[model samples]
Target: MSDTRRRPRHVGAKLLLLILVCYFLVPVWWLVVASTKNAEGLFAGDGALWFSGFHLADNLRHLITINNGEYLRWLGNSLLYASAGGIGCTIVSVLAGYGFAKFDFRGRNIVFAMVLGSVMVPLTALVIPTFVMMSNAGLTDTIWAVILPSLLSPFAVYLMRVYAAASVPDELLDAARIDGAGELRTFVRVALPLMRPGVVTVLLLSVVSTWNNYFLPLTMLSSSKLYPLTVGLGLWTQLASSNNGGGESLWNLIITGSLVSIVPLVIAFLTLQKYWQSGLAAGSVK
Candidate 1:
């Protein structure tokens, strides 16, 4: 009787998991199929989720060669923004989180409370104010307008704080201090090594956020050359749907560019997966 009940529960869980997997994967499958089709095949294809033709090479070639390689410039811009913002944000989050977790000082709780509160605020809401500030500073339409803003992530900092507190021990830190290690040495040699997983996690989050960020960059930058893939693709989508000029011909290129845009993010996650897993294992052992 107990075995019968457990078997049914297990089957139900598997069914639910399968549903979730399909829900997430189906769209990706559609995008993959769509990228291989031409303008004609995209609308009147065999099926939306099935390949209609193998025009992927043509689509990719067009994607790179169009408008004097504007797509490639967008790709390079995205890489630059994501790399700079991710690394900078990760460094800031790690240091700030380590301090918040380990340090004792006046008004620490109050300051942290503000940081926590900021996380509750929608990022879109801040875009206008941030844009205004950038405009005032005469930095609008420049790379700094995007990269500088991407550096501060309240949730990343909060996540890092929680990870540092749980993963790094006060006793261990005290021992490091007692061993004549300076604060910087202790952080670099002792605390940081233990927080590897959290650092990687923050790095991935910041990179993905900056890479996919559309509204912020849109509001801050007016130049097409500085546009990231998100904004660039969004522009293509607008043009393709507007029913004006040669916009309709860009549909296939849009789909192909999107597929290309995601490759870096996939590579980043796969490359960092081992470090993330190792960190989790280390945390569990501690």
Candidate 2:
């Protein structure tokens, strides 16, 4: 009886896990297959989940050469936005989190409460107001319009605060202070090293956030030259579906571009996964 009960639970757990695995992996498998086909092959009404032809090379060439190589420019813009904005956002989060976690200031709790409250608020709801403010500042349709707004991330700040509190010890900071180290010096030399895991985590989060950002860039930028990969691909997708009876449909390009788009994110995680893992371990070491 005992073995039978345990066996059923184990089977159920494995079945549930298999379902989840398929749920995520199936789309990826379909994309891989769909990306290898032309419009005819893609919408051929069969074998979408199975590779039917080898058009990956041809699709990639068209992807890069289309619209006079605008895709490359869009990719460059995305790189600039995600890398630069992520770095700035990570730094701000770390500093703010460290201050919040370590220091005792007037209205500290109140300020943190407000920050936490902002986290509960959806970023989508703020786009219109953010756009209005950017418009007033005369920054619309420029790269700055997208970059400036992403610099401040409330969620990253909260993560850093928790990490700083847990990873950094007050006694060490007090010792550094007694040794005549300035606040800035202590943070740079002492606190930062101790909070590496948290910093890495926040950095990764910020990068991913900026990378996948579509709505803000869509609303802020109007110039095609300044569009990032997300917005650029979206425009192509729209054109493909616009049904103007163009020379050929662009569903292949869409699938292929999307596949290309995710490559960076996959590379990012693969490159940083070890560091992220280390950071997580450090954060949990206490």
Candidate 3:
């Protein structure tokens, strides 16, 4: 009698999970299908969710060749920005978080409270203020304008603090101290290894945020040569929408560029998946 009752609940949960899977995957499937079609086929193709023809190669060729290969330049800029910002932000967050978790100092609560408060404020709200500061500092239109602002992620710091407090134990640090390990040595040799999972999580989040950043870069950079993929693709979209010429052709290129832009992020996630898997295994063993 109990078995019959549990069967329906299990079946219902599986059905719900299947529905969510389809909901997320449908758009990706559409993107893949649309990338294969020309602009005309994309809008007036035989099916919206199915491939009409394969023009992906021609579109990619044009994507790289058009405007002296501007798309490639944008791709490189994004890579540089994301890699630099992500790694820098991860370092800052880890140090700040570890300090907060392990040490006690006057005004610590007050400062951490301010950080937590800042997290509630939307990043878009701060762009104008950031632009003004960058302007005053003579950094506007330079890579520093974008990269500097991205290096401070309050949320990442908060995440690291929470993870550090939970994952790192006071007893372990005390043991390291009794063994004559200095604070720096203790952190690098003992605490850091245990914090690997949190570090990787924060790293991936920072990387994705920097890679997809658009509005801040848009506000800060005016030169097309300095534009990242987000800003560059946005420019193509705006130009394509206007009635100058070659609207549909540009649209095709835009679709292909959008598809190409996501490849690096996908590759990064897949490549780093094993680190997370190993981290989980280590945690389980402990």
Candidate 4:
């Protein structure tokens, strides 16, 4: 009798999930197919959504060789900004969250409420104010302009606080305190291990956010040398679109470069998705 009841739900869920998978994968599949085509194949408009010819290698060679390999520099800059900023953001969020979750100080509720409220505010709204502050601090048009603003994510902080409250046991912290462990030491040695899933989850979110950031970098960086892949690719597309001459056909490079840029993010997400899933599922079963 239970089997009969469960069968419909299972089948329905699988159908829903299959639809979602196709919804997301179709765009990626189109990108992959489009990336392998040259200008003629792409603009031919007949096989735009499928693999008509394999010119991926030729496109990649042109991408790498363009303007003395500017794409590689952009990729490296993205890695540095995303990795460093993500790690820094995770550390700050975890510390602030732990302090909030474990300790009871002045304005605790009010402060947490404020943090929650801040999470509701979009980063886009704050960009102009942030730019002004960065300008006053003489940080405009520098790497710090991009990196400093990314070091604290209010959403991550709220997430960490909630996860730490549930996942990290008070008993373990008390035991560590009893053993002459300072708050920092306890957090580093005992509490952090139990919250690995949460940290990894926050870290990956930070990485993705930093990787796809375009407007801040666009406003802060005036030099082509410091541009990340997002800005650089946009610039290339703009330049190509404005010029109709045969010498300036760069749609293939832009498409191929975009495909290459997303590869790292895909790898990182696939590698860390298990930890993120575990974090989300932490208290569900219990």
Q: Which one wins on TM-score?
A: 1
- Candidate 3 global lDDT: 0.91
Tens-digit lDDT track of model 1 for 1-286: 9998899899999999999999999989988999999888887846898887799999999999999999999999999999999999999999999999999999999999999999999999999999889989999999999999999999998988989998899999999999999999999999998898889989998999999999998898889999999999998888888964356578889989999999999999899998767655654655
Residue pair clashes in candidate 2: 197-279
**For model 1, what is the error of residue 246's alpha carbon versus the real structure, in angstroms, after optimal superposition?**
2.7
- lDDT (Cα atoms) of all candidates against the true structure: 0.91, 0.90, 0.91, 0.91
Report the Cα lDDT for residue 110, model 2.
98
Residues 1-286, candidate 4, lDDT per residue (tens digit)? 9999999999999999999999999989888998899888888889767789899999998889888999999999999999989999999999998989999999999999998999888888889999999999999988899999999899999999989998999998999999999988998999999989999999999999999999989988899999999999999888888874233358888889999999999999999999989988888856
lDDT measured at residue 152 in model 4 versus the true structure, 0 to 100: 82
| Ranking of all candidate structures by their TM-score, best first | 1, 2, 3, 4
lDDT (10s digit) by residue, model 3, range 1-286: 9999999999999999999999999988888888899888987946989888899998899899999999999999999999999999999999999999899999999999999999999999999999999999999999999899989999988888887887899999999999999999999999999899888878888999999999999999999999999999999989888944478888888888999999988998898887666544544534
Worst 10 residues of 2 by lDDT: 243-252
Could you tell me the C-alpha RMSD of candidate 3 in Å?
2.2
| Candidate 4 lDDT | 0.91
lDDT of model 2 at residue 227? Answer: 93
